[model samples]
Target: MPETGRREPGAPANVPAARPADDPRPSAPPELDYNGRRHRRAMDDATLWDMARRIPTALAQTARLAWSVDRRMTATILVCQVLSGLGTAVMLTAVSRALPHLTASDARTGLTQAWPALTVAVAAMATGSGMWILADWATRRLNPKIASAADLTLVDLHMKAELSAYDTEGFTDRSQAAEIGAMRAVDLADDAKTLTGGFVQLVSAATVLTSLHPLLLGVLVLSVLPRGLGGVIAARIDYRVHDRTISARNVRGMMRWWLTTSELADELRANTMRPYLQSWYRAMCDRVEGRELEGARPYLLVTLLAASLSGLFTLGMWVSLAALAVSGAMSTAIAGTAIVASQTAGRALNSIVRYGAVMFHHGLYLSDYHTFIGEVRSSATARGTTRAPAPRRIRLCGAGFTYPGRDEPALHPVTLTLERGEIVALVGENGAGKSTLIRMITGLTVPTAGSVRWDDTDLATADAESAWRHVGLVPQKNGHWPLRVRENITLGQPREHGDEGVWDAAGRVGMTEALERLPDGLDTLLARSVWGGHELSGGQWQRLACARAMYREPAVLVLDEPTSEMDARGEHLIFRELRAMARDRITVVVTHRLDNVRMADRVIVLDQGRVREQGTFDDLVATEGSLLGELYALAQDR
Candidate 1:
């Protein structure tokens, strides 16, 4: 029978209907489809000449980084490189000078005359070898230090970036690329050294070859040009693959984390999700592998063509040298010296091509690092000079927030005031703007429209650091830090009161007994057993989070679903403590547990990003057609 389908009730007409079981159309893997839609900004193709032109800039940047890390090592490496080049030059010159005498008909007399030149040749060779050893020693020590510095810089940048940057599109991908670039900083340094050494060797060999016959220098250039072109092409292909597969690779990493992490272990097995997740992982792997293999095809072809052309040019070069020697246009000794110089020059050229390609590849990543750093710096929050004191009142005047790339605001403009010595309950369904409202009240996010003021001070123009000092927040999803029990409670900021303050906060959340039962009391590490630490149950962790907030004892306290993980007794104890603590500070609690609203001094009900009702719990519950009353009655029935 011919397939037919009808759109589900209220379904958008534009939505496509499902295909039949025997449909012949092929479907792309989800990962591949996602990868295709991403906006890739990979490095573009460049000619060998373009790469050669940019080499000096990359070398200079590497030099500056090396000098900044350790000037003494940089100077030592530079001096050794120059001396090594000079040694090669002197050795070649000495050999050329002694060749004729050593090959003369009266070999004994010729040998006697050649001893001085031979001695110089041996000394130059020894000097070159010594310099190489010293340079290698310095490089081994210096490269690690350079890499460490790069990583530190990147980490510091990440720490200072604004919280909103993490939510921005493409930000995570950029950060990953920057991290890769930072890790390869040492490789760039090593490549710079190789490039410098290759240039010196090329120069030394070219000078000797030119002295023998100018035509040999031309032949040397022709012999290596093909390889250089091939290298540049290969580098472009590699970067293109890297750029295109970033999203797929990142997805694979996330899936691996999901599969391996303890947080999802029980649920994964209970839901029988391993096979599905593994299949997704394998799909991503296959896609990445296919991309890599496809990228390698052109590189292999280029390498073959380059090698073949290079072989032809090299044979012609040797044939020309032999012709000159046989025609007596050059002496046998000069011809023999030319052979050694040609080989040296050829190797130097090959090194330049190989290292230059690798260096350029690393440079692309380095550019990503620099670009991300610049972006982070630009997006970083600018702290105002005005200091903010502990506020007695927080006022939101027509405040609203719209996230990036979205037309509708997550929070609608609604004027509200929260004053000292009041406990306000924010009651709302999911996506009713309760969390967004609390974030605004705490000054965690700046309002895109209108203003938020702490007393008389506008948060937008106040020092964020100073303002945050007065705010204590227990978010819906709290951090599970792998630190000591005491450190977790204090959040690494131990006050002068120390354990006294920690214990007081723990007591308020009824966590003192739980903490005391641990093997090391307050000193016990809070991590999984495999890590030589003890993990806490979900409720215990929630108590720890509440204690952390209580320890701060700030002027403004915000709790979002803080008691969701606790039992009835534990939840009652938390609310009783919050009421007692609310006498001196402003406390805002966001919860769906409508029964808890009776303890609040005032209740604010939100629906669809707007305040729908406001009053005491008794008054709202008594009123007719009240959203809070309706919600509370529904909760009672459930």
Candidate 2:
């Protein structure tokens, strides 16, 4: 009810860290700047080399994830890849043998001599192709399962995170990073598959080259080493740039959203906000592009140099093979096989380098996801597991609360009791802690000092789920669920209620007639985005929120400015129903509407996070100089 996100109501100086919000881990040491730009973590030459070195480990971790999802598919891919590599080697050997045989004899004899070798070569190619296809098929089947497992991990962490964790701005950044990281986990898997295939092909080519001539092996290594290293360095540069620009991207997105969202569209157009927004967007885009270019500049030159060096090495290797054939150190057929093998090896090595870089980039993001999940577990607010039974009364004794990193308290130490069948009204000015008090009653927040107890059980040590089961809240800003009319009211509560129960709750809020006018009644979708869906007015949506609370039938009900958008008739009807509803449950209402306070059994006035006065509405109204009397008089004057 108190704007559930981490908002510092009275304090403006408490800034949360900029690191991923959900990552509870300590921040890494300061990053080293490169090319006059700051990055999330420094990517100096040494660090880049270190990250490149870790690619193999990262790829292995990704494979483990894939193996976990489908062991059978993983095994199949492994077997097929090994067989494919062997088949490639055998095909190369058969080609070498057949070529020599075809050229060594008379025409008729040459055909007879080459036939057996050619048949062997064709068979090996067919087997290798079949194995390659099988491996690809298995990898595709395994990818979605790996992604699903990662998604489930993220969802579990999201649901378990404590409300207090959101008090910091870092939580949002970290949560977004984690969400993106979840998808990266799937990329990591794809990278693993690519690495596996590439490694096999590289090994096959290398083996054939070594068997043909030892000198060719040295040429293969020289050709690939520079390019592979350059690719890894390039990946690190791109990742650092992307990570540094996350905040800029967030700013740009928010600026775009301001112009695009339906809530702001009309006002923005009326106020001529386009030019201002465009200027801000341009600034963010400049910042993003500058950082990207700075990171990429160092790699572009290295990449071009590597490409040139690779071309030179490739030419030299081919020349060496031609020389060997011309000098009779190697047969023409063997030299030809070596040439083909060298080209195959080069492509395979390139793939290995490319996929390794991809794995390293995605692996870092995946690590963030894993860390965030751990943080969610450790920072969860509900530490108690003892289930509390439904209570006749709840008491706050010397309870106070101050948001983390804030000097000023949101709520001052105060004592209060809410008993069944009592309707209490909390009246206050803006930031008077009315909503904070309501949240305290609902167990959404725990006090910094003293305790809030349900009957005799301290809420901090009670099962949060059980406490929630007996409470219902209609927040200041109700959610607009993209669901059917029936599902919207019954979102949180179990499906104990059928259509009749839904209508009964709606009837109590005087919303049944409005619902009945719908094309599909309870079945109508509430979202404007859905085809054939019906949209409700603000007051109508407020009534539906109230209906949801009524349907819950909880022991405690907390309503924060529930009729802020309702018409006079609608507000009167709701307050009347609330009075009747409170006859069997404890109702705590925070409102600016003085007329609604008239129905309360008692009224409590709050000023600056402290209780200023308390009495029946009539008594407070009669008591001059009291906060409640002043507010009531002011409302009447207005």
Candidate 3:
């Protein structure tokens, strides 16, 4: 009694309804769901020991990256950091040796005796300052190089990945995370340097404290441990908040792009969508801000407790030092020196706590970068070594394709042959597998079942790059490159014959007259956003896309809804050119315009991913009750 696959009354048919876990139909990938799961796992698994372990690993990785970019600069920075630490120790030692002389009862004698020690102290101070300057100079030059290298590596990985990888589950989420990691790579050098500097300072100051008194070193650790623990706790909380709010932040970014982008400005105002989008953006912002505030509460509380404990310990340490002086167990000069060492040690401890936490946080993102690169490299497309010659015939033997995570195939197994110098046209309704079949024929997608071959070379075994040299395709949605018309037509590969070939192709597509009207002719930039650039109308852009494909002079030419936006005259001119060009190339056209099929040598009608009819155009029109005839009659009446 009820219609199959129907929803209940009052349900909107176009809007997607929730499906059961076992549903056979395909659904859009849940991008945020994947992001949340992976990010949560990474954050939740991090423990105190794990954080400690990750710090050195992160520093080593940063060092390796810096070394690869510029080894001389990296070595200079390392030597500067090490020498700076030694300079601090020498300066403190000189000051300690000068204390007794400077404090002697005879003022003139104290000045004379302390002169050499004071001179040594001044020179050590200058050396430390000079090393800081050198390190800073080298870092400024190296950080940009590191960031550029990271960005290039990410782009290279993206170029190598198979086209199908983009549609795979979790791939997009991993890519976004990897991009964040790549951007943070610029911070890696600073984080590592700060961490290294802190550790050096701690070691130098601790050695000075030990020389003064072994018990003083113990007091120093007691005073600083609470603060270090607090920093680690706060970092953990911050990472959790960041992981949880990533999805919401990504949504806000998308909303912001839609609101500000020039391409959508007109439609946004025309449809009065600004307020709706603004409200959506504000909601996501509030969600992220709420999570941050929640995280901040615990962080503030931990820092407060840590600071209170540290203050008490510092007071006790000062009291102990004064008692040692008063009890005559140490001299007044030694006590004063100990005071200076304590202050230096305190500052060094603070640096260690602060920079260590930062390095740990950055390490989490760096992990994402390494994971994504490995995954992409392992899954990169493998083009066979067998070189393929130019195709004379293309054949598909029972080729079918089913998308990832779907039970039903997008296209049924198809058996067909296309010969050079023959023009074939495909007719179909929406979602009738026409585009899928075209992609299979063009080698853009590999079939899940069966094989596609060019001459005797199977696409699965032949070299993809070599086989692609003879194919040219124009899809329904063509790219609008912001380049000069000449470069756009040639796709940056200029022919040896130059503008003569460009003009010939433009004339065939009826674009030569329009191009000639421009101030720079073929040199005109097709981006209105750029200075001195020109823009073309929808029909003119379509004509340009057609001309680009024709310029290739490919052995196989495939056009999908190529003239959808063109006027009657422009459309007629393109079909006439196609008829002439079909004499040498294997041309396949996908169009819903029934009138255009009259120019095709053979017409194949598709319905629900299966071939329903195939014959010459005149023969199909003459047949009684044929699907093509019925579709043509309906179009004529409209």
Q: For candidate 3, write residues 219-316 as lDDT tens digits.
A: 78877777777776766677788877877787678778878877899999999876556655665677688889999889899889888887788788
Candidate 1 residue pairs in clash (backbone atoms < 3 Å): none
lDDT, candidates in the order shown: 0.82, 0.80, 0.82
Instruction: Please give the ranking of all candidate structures by lDDT, highest first, separated by commas.
Output: 1, 3, 2
List the pairs of residues colliding in candidate 3.
none
**In each prediction, how many residue pairs overlap at the backbone (N, C-alpha, C within less than 3 A)?**
0, 3, 0
lDDT of 2: 0.80
Please, what are the lDDT tens digits per residue for candidate 1 over residues 1-638?
12224556886553445556896432223533253432244336465566676667667778888999999888888999889888888888888889899989999999999999989999998998799779877887789989999899889877767666777888888898888878888676677787888889889888877877787778778767766666666667777887778777877888888888888999999998776666556767887888888888887888898888878877876788788888988877777777777677767777787788667666667777888989998866565778888889999999998776678888899899999999999998999999888878887777889999999999888877778888889999999899999999888455768789989999999998988899999999988745789999888898899899889988999999899999998999999999999977899998888888789999999998889999899999999999888887888898
Listed per candidate, the RMSD to the true structure in angstroms reads 5.7, 8.9, 7.5
**Model 2 segments more than 4 A misplaced:** 1-48, 96-99, 102-120, 229-265, 268-305, 331-333, 530-532
Error of 3 at 596 (Å): 2.2
Off by over 4 Å in 1: 1-44, 49-57, 108-112, 167-169, 230-259, 263-305
* Model 2's TM-score against the true structure: 0.83
The estimated TM-scores of all candidates read 0.85, 0.83, 0.85
lDDT of 2 by residue, 467-542 (tens): 8898889999999898999998887997686888899989988898899999999999998745658899999999
* lDDT for model 3: 0.82
Pitting candidate 1 against candidate 2, the one with the higher TM-score is: 1
